[model samples]
Target: MLILGIETSCDETAAAVVADGRTILSEVTLSQDLHNLYGGVVPELASREHTRTLVPVVREAISEAEISYDDLEGIAVTNGPGLVGALLVGLSFAKALSYSLNKPLVGINHLEAHIFSVLLERPELVPPFLCLIISGGHSNLYLVESLGRYRSIGSTRDDAAGEAFDKVAKLLGLGYPGGPAIDEVAKSGNRDFIKFPKARMKSGGYDFSFSGLKTAVAIYVSKLNEKELQKRRADIAASFQEAVVGALLDNTIAAAEEHRMARIAVCGGVASNSRLRERLKASSETQGLLVFYPSLELCTDNAAMVAAAGNFRLENFPPDDLELDAFPYLELGD
Candidate 1:
């Protein structure tokens, strides 16, 4: 089936055309740069950008796919678990398009789409695996049973790993979107230069917590003189990155062991981090487990993932009606 996917879950306004879930024919994404100035996403600005570019992006995807609108078998749209206004812009547009095209409409869960992002590249991936999804606003471990079937095993208790990175970067004056900033700076520094605390739950919960780690970095920075902090910034970045990724890898590996799952995948924005990727692959290698992930381009929010997920839903699930609305906080399969 040829599926048209629309995604405006956050700052990115994206659209894509995919064939039978595995083949991505064309994808277009326009990221809103307004958030860069604010050091975080501004929902209102994101929604405006979506409204401005939605049509052109979808049209471009279709054009690039070398297919007319009538060729599309169905339309998939991210319906929830994102900023409401931004989501509405895409959801509303998708609804209109679906109605006009007379194609099946599938409302996708933004988070669920992230999982399919990896599967889009690895269509034969076996299920009953563990997935660690780390991004700007989310960090969770899910046991994926099959397409559209997920059970949350663990999740963040406070700030997500990427959120911590952004906060720490702002503290260090590194810049917005802290993951890349810290990754670049940490390259020349020593990962062991300054050890940060890694929070392990006292109650033995499978959930992750980065709030304490962020606070530890904040307190450490408070004690440093401006000159010393500046001179050791690289070391700080390396050390902090090590602590965060280390804790994440350790818990994830432990989860795989506990669950006896051989395949582990990482998704979402932070999946693009070189350190996390390296560490995760290295760790999985030692345990004789398989690790899967999307390419760098697929790590962040994109319509290709949305399209892949939509294809799955459109095939197995009944089509949704035009009354389908944007769900800002919709939990998957709830």
Candidate 2:
């Protein structure tokens, strides 16, 4: 089936045309840079940008795919778990397209779409695997039983890993979107320069906690003079990154061992982190387990994954109605 996927969950306005969910014919994404000025995403500005850019982006995606609207078998959109106004733009537009083209429409959960991202490149991958989704807004682990079937195993109790990266970077005067900035600088610094605390859950579950780690970094920076901070910035980044990576890896490995799952899939924006990828590779080799990650382009928010997920839902479930509303805080499995 050929599907057109629309995504406006956050600052990105994206559209894509995918064939049978696995093959991407064309995809176009426009990221709003206005968020950088504020050191984070401003919801109001993000909604306005999506309204302005979504039409052009969708047109370009369809044009690049070399298919007319008549060729589309269905329309898919992210309807919830994102900025409400931003999601409404995509949802409303998709609903209109579904009505005009008389094609089926499906509303996809943003997080669930992230999980299906792996299938866009590896369609043959089977289920019964563990998945860790770490991003700016979320950090969660799930046991994926099959398409549309997920059992959450763990999640962040406070700030997510990426959120911590951003907060720490801001305190250190590092720029917005802290993951790349910290990862790049940490390459030259020593990961052992400072020993940061890695939180362990007292309940002995797979849950994660990064708020204390963020506080630790904040406290450490408080005592540093201007010259001292400049001298040890890279070391700070390296040490902090090490701590976050350790915490994430520990829980993931533990979950995989406890469940006896051999395949581990890491998805979301943070999946693009070089250090995380390198560490996962090492762990896979040491433990003799299969590890999978979406391509860099697929790591962040995109419509291809939404389209892929919609393809599955459209096939197995009834089409969502035109009245389908935006769910800003919808949880997975809801």
Q: Top TM-score: which candidate number?
A: 2
Off by over 4 Å in 2: none
Question: What lDDT is reached at residue 59 by model 1?
Answer: 87
* TM-scores, each model vs. reference: 0.97, 0.98
The Cα error of candidate 1 at residue 258, in Å, is 0.7
Model 1 clashing residue pairs (backbone) = none
RMSD for all candidates, in order, please: 1.2, 1.0
Residues 1-334 of candidate 2 have per-residue lDDT tens digits of: 9999999999899999999989999989898988988988899999999989988999999999999999999999999898999999999999998998999999999998998899789865789899999988889999988778898889999998898999998878999889888988889889999999999899888899999999999999999998999999999999999999999999999899999999999998888888888998999899988998999999888999999999999989999998899999888852
Per-residue alpha-carbon lDDT of model 1 for 63-84, expressed as tens digits? 9999999999999999988999
TM-score of 1: 0.97
Best by lDDT: 2
- Which runs in model 1 stand beyond 4 Å of their true positions? none
Model 2 error, position 76 (Å): 0.6
